[model samples]
Target: MLESLTMVRHGESAGNAALAEAITAGAEESGPGLRDSDIPLSDLGRAQAGAVGKWLARQWDSVDAVLCSPYVRALETAEIALRAGRAPAVRVDERLRDREQGLLGGLTELGVQRRYPAEAAARELMGRFYYRPPGGEAWTDVALRLRTLLPELEGHVLVFAHDLVIVMVRYILDDLDESTILKIESNQLANASISRWERDHSGLRLLKYNDVGHLQ
Candidate 1:
């Protein structure tokens, strides 16, 4: 079995909190545009991160390494988790950043749909995984970027990245179709939710997904 690697999403962000409001507003129908990448995490998100770190510490005697996205939310989550668990130093990588929302960035979902119905519909139908932002990347693009970061592989690596990045990575590992990519749960992961994987002769197999037992 390949050494176990733990992948987790950053703690709660303005996006996650706004999610309920966005959905309630029916932004999809009204066309509020999607938000951009700069949003930071909420206090709850930070606490969740600490909880995750505590959980990791209890579960593993030691974590060999840490890799994280350069984004503020992800970086903060990684840092908090490491500090809580006494984890190793974390290495920041742009390859692990969230999916580019493109022209849609900063707009509410309904706002965007109303403003650019065609674009919004296209993005929803085609999904962001394979769809490229006007100047941004497709889901495949993100995966390619992450591929460059993969080493021969190391021990107990903890990765903190965006939700879309997490989903696309699952596609790469599971060999799932881009069309069906969104069908799988976004795996946005609770503030500190964790997923584990192990590589074998065949490939990496997910041992767990969206585990937030630590928060409880």
Candidate 2:
């Protein structure tokens, strides 16, 4: 079986913009719109999506299918990229959604940390790959879902998800443990950047990781 899999994270959202502004102003305040799902993309995010779509349109004959998280930012990113070509069938899979934040959802980084000191400490100590938000999922759980779904994919496929999802899925596909996975930068896969991998006799091989030059 010939399979080419490409993964991408959703574009920057209003949450991102808010955070950026806060950072620019040197304020540690948290915003109220950083939900775990369906955060709309910002203007820069749209630009990134368009650029990624154009790049992908040139890189492959066509995407066989697009599997996306139901989050608005992810859906928008996938739609923008697919529309650049003949447009592939888009499928919504909850398994691909962002890490659930529970009460931390819709809060800024400071807000989450301040609200859930123990959970925040846990996340910081364990790293994002293994960190589990209170009343939320752990990386192992996300890995299980991805493992169950990945083998079912056929042909060329594109997945649009969140940073943690990408890292966890990559960990499973690459057969790496927490150590190696933890070494990877969380933003290694930029907002519209794409990472490619394919299966071989040995197993899945990493052809590339986090290619965002197209956005430049």
Candidate 3:
């Protein structure tokens, strides 16, 4: 069983900022759409990653292994964080990549509403967990991937991935029901925030959830 796990969403990416802008604008204007794999980190993202690195440096003894997503944004965050802290090198894991957005790849929520209203309605009716956008993954698919990856982990490990990975890992680790998971995901997680779990005799216990105090 994994002894300890720490997960963090990648630093703010160009894609992340663009999506937020579209959400704020109600997706009226063309959003900054790009393939998930191509997104790069923003300036603030670099600073945020550096901040987390300092925090990680203080806890250097707590981490023995590090894993990261293959996406550009996530990979950059891991590189920057580890480099700043002078910590252990990280391994790339495709399974840690963001849930495929597919047809919903670049569009904001409002874009989904306007361009694919039927699909949007179906998603709301079926609920977010089961709603797989065309050519994309449902939450369950991501959950299965993490479940498989869990057994592969050992010792103190740190993960740098995406928002979905952070949330779904909890869903699997805690044995949460779909309804419960949805409730938690609705709040979402901020970019560069940290979430951690430690194992005890009973089971894994959440030590932190979406913590960004270091950035402050």
Which candidate comes out best when scored by TM-score? 3
Q: Report how far residue 23 has shifted in candidate 2, in Å.
A: 4.1
lDDT of each: 0.73, 0.78, 0.87
Question: What TM-score would each prediction reach against the true structure?
Answer: 0.83, 0.87, 0.94
Kindly report which residue pairs in candidate 2 clash with one another. Answer: 34-106, 35-106, 38-72
- Shift in Å, residue 153, candidate 3: 0.3
**lDDT digits (tens) for residues 4-84 of candidate 1:** 678888998867777667678765431223334566778999888888777777855646778888888898888777774
Find the number of clashing residue pairs for candidate 1. Answer: 19
Candidate 1: 10-residue stretch with minimal lDDT: 28-37
Give the poorly placed runs of model 1, Cα more than 4 Å off: 26-37, 59-62, 124-127, 186-189, 200-203
Per-residue lDDT over 1-216 for candidate 3, one digit per residue giving the tens place of the 0 to 100 score:
589999989999987787777777776433345567878899999889988888888877878889999999999988888884645778999999999977877776777888889999989898889999999999999998988899999988999999999999999888899889888888879999999999998989999998999889
TM-score of 1: 0.83
- Using lDDT as the yardstick, the better of models 1 and 2 is 2
Candidate 2 differs from the real structure by a C-alpha RMSD in angstroms, to one decimal, of 2.4
Worst 10 residues of 3 by lDDT: 26-35
Best by lDDT: 3
Residue range 19-74, candidate 2, lDDT tens digits: 77776775556443545474788888888889888888785564687799999999
Clashes of each: 19, 3, 0
Badly placed stretches (over 4 Å) of model 2 are 23-35, 60-62, 122-128, 186-188
